[model samples]
Target: MKIAILGAGYGGMAAAFDLLRAGQDVTVFESAEAAGGLAAGFKAPGWDWSVERFYHHWFQSDAHMLKLMDDLGLRHKMLFPRPKTVMYHRGKFYPFDSIPAALLYPGLGWGVNKIRFGLVGLYLRLTNNWQPLEQTTVEAWMRKWAGDSVYREMWEPMLVGKFGERYAQQVNMAWMWARLHARTTRLGTYQGGFQAFSDDFAAHLRGLGGKILFSTPVTALQSEADGSWTVRSAAGDQRFDRVLSTTSPGWMARLAPQLPEDYLKGLLELKHLGAVVMVLALRRQLSPQGYYWYNLPKSAGFPYLALVEHTNFVSPEHFGGDHILYMGDYLETDHAYFQMSQEELLERFLPSLARINPDFQPDWVRQSWLFRTPYAQPVPLLNHSRHIPAVRTPLAGLYFASMSQVYPWDRGTNFAVEIGRRAAEMILTDGQA
Candidate 1:
């Protein structure tokens, strides 16, 4: 049997690896020259240190990722540490990660609001799970728990920052549950870098005789009369008994319009928020404890929404005692922030830095790199379930393994890999049936 997987992202790579293990011929096509789509890493010009454009970390619940790393013999490099996360509100930083911190948090009032917030969170963690969250929007859910004041002061800004204008009134509850559950951890990263897992996965696939074609963008797809799909790319076309797509559903609608009109419409309707992350390699560390801090109640015209003092979480010595900070913004593609030049973004970032770190100066910045990923995150609005396209399309010889399928679960390497494995199993069984 032959299989073709599009997009060398986690889902595609996972599907390719599993199919190869099943003794099937698998080929993966990636538009970029490397694997790890959104998770890909880039090294500095002269340094061995590398980091992902967007931050990535693993939680204890990410079983598939942990298992995959163990199987690949990269377990030794996996480092699980008690990472610190804080929140910035009213020009003050507050620790809000641990349960103790939650109880002691002063930013939130000491009244019904705090009690309601704690109860809702506890219910979410202990009972509701992610399934119930799917049926309601975050707005309604939050209002039910507390009130408009809490939502306005605490939640709305976060929603806007993460989802841009797509922070619809009816954003899905499942999305919030997944975010809350999966994120309850100290976080872990590889001793080398998060990309190490991607590199290892690609190498394992190659070792298993799976072919990966980089710089290959699938422009069109058609199902032949012979009950197979022929995927055409810049390189050429190939016929596969089974086809799986991990590309964003929006991109899928553009590449292969064979799906139903409504499905395609939903894909088009699915909104995404873009991001521009400016990474600064500095001569000195930004924060004292090297904690991750999210700027809340986003100030007007701030260049970045959050400042991740990575060195605070990880040792600066890892990057040769130099601090690495990530200042990121979530904006619409049409937003001026996206079109701003590197120098313009830099100019805006400096003032924000001085606010957070009074001693921050231009000379402290050794180097800066800007990264922009279009359609970076999907906004799971209230009716998110309705927006997700079916995995098994009406057409034959086609399947999908996408982040959209992991609806209640936020997009992650672990979820993508599990989805790929599940899709592969279904495809194999369907073939036999």
Candidate 2:
């Protein structure tokens, strides 16, 4: 069977890889010039490695992603680094990545709050039962079990950071559980970065007789009377035995007019948040204590959600000893940051850096870049799992895969690969039938 993959993201590429291994003819259509989708990156002239436009890292528990690299014979290029992650509380940053660190942190104050926090964490870690968690809001669940003090001190700030105060209440507990349960202090990345991994993945697909068309945006998916699907792009319309769309639900609704009205409505109904990020190449480190992730809270007068020093996580030496930092936030599509230019955003985000490190100077920043995406996070409301779109759409021979469908699990590269391969298996099974 000839397969067409719309969007050369990890999901699309993973699906294509599986189909190619099954001796199926596969072609990938990408709007961007390269692969990795949201994980795509760029580099400086003197830099040997690339940095992502949006920040990305893998947890130790990201089995699906780790397995893929090992299978691809690129394990040696992977780096697992122990990076310090801090939470900004009151006027200071406190180390809070591990259990011991959390207990030692002063924000929780007393014994009862600490005990409640530990018990709730133990429950989340020990139980594989998460379906019920989907029905409960993180706000309610944390308050009830972890108590108000623990929830407010440790979790509420992060909720505000990720979803803003407006949508934070609507977020379910399962999403929060996955966030805490899946991550590790030791983060993983490729030697040259995620972009290099994507390039290698694309090259590997091509080597296996799969065709990847870059700078080709798929405009529509139409069904032929003979049962095949037509992919219309800038190049022209081409027929395929099966087609998979790795775009957001909103894009899927836009691209496939042949889908059932009910299906299209469901796709349109999926709620999501966009991201605005400012990446900087600096002459000196941003965090003096070598902290990698700073989870900022709006309550503390932070203008953004997260402040990640990528160079601190890995090493500045890989990029000609340039300190790299990312100031990012997840906001509604209409947020003002989306409209702000690099200079405008810098003005808003930079002053806060001095609050972290007193010596931070504007001159420390060498170059800055602004990146914004309309679909960065999928909002998981109560019983969100039930609302998740199926990989097999109502239309025959056409499948859907996107970050939105990665419900109960936060959108990231690991689940992208997992769903992509799972969808590919479904397509092959259908082909056999």
Q: Of the candidates shown, which would achieve the greatest TM-score relative to the real structure?
A: 2
All candidates: TM-score = 0.94, 0.99
Candidate topping lDDT: 2
Residue 290, candidate 2: how far off, in angstroms? 0.7
Clashing pairs in 1: 133-174, 170-382, 171-381, 171-382, 172-381, 172-382, 290-312
In terms of lDDT, the poorest run of 10 residues in model 1 is: 294-303
Give the RMSD in angstroms, all C-alphas superposed, for model 1: 2.0
Q: What lDDT does the true structure give each of the candidates?
A: 0.78, 0.91
The reply for model 2, stretches above 4 Å from the true place, is none
Clash counts per candidate, in order, are 7, 0
Poorly placed runs, candidate 1 (over 4 Å): 128-132, 165-168
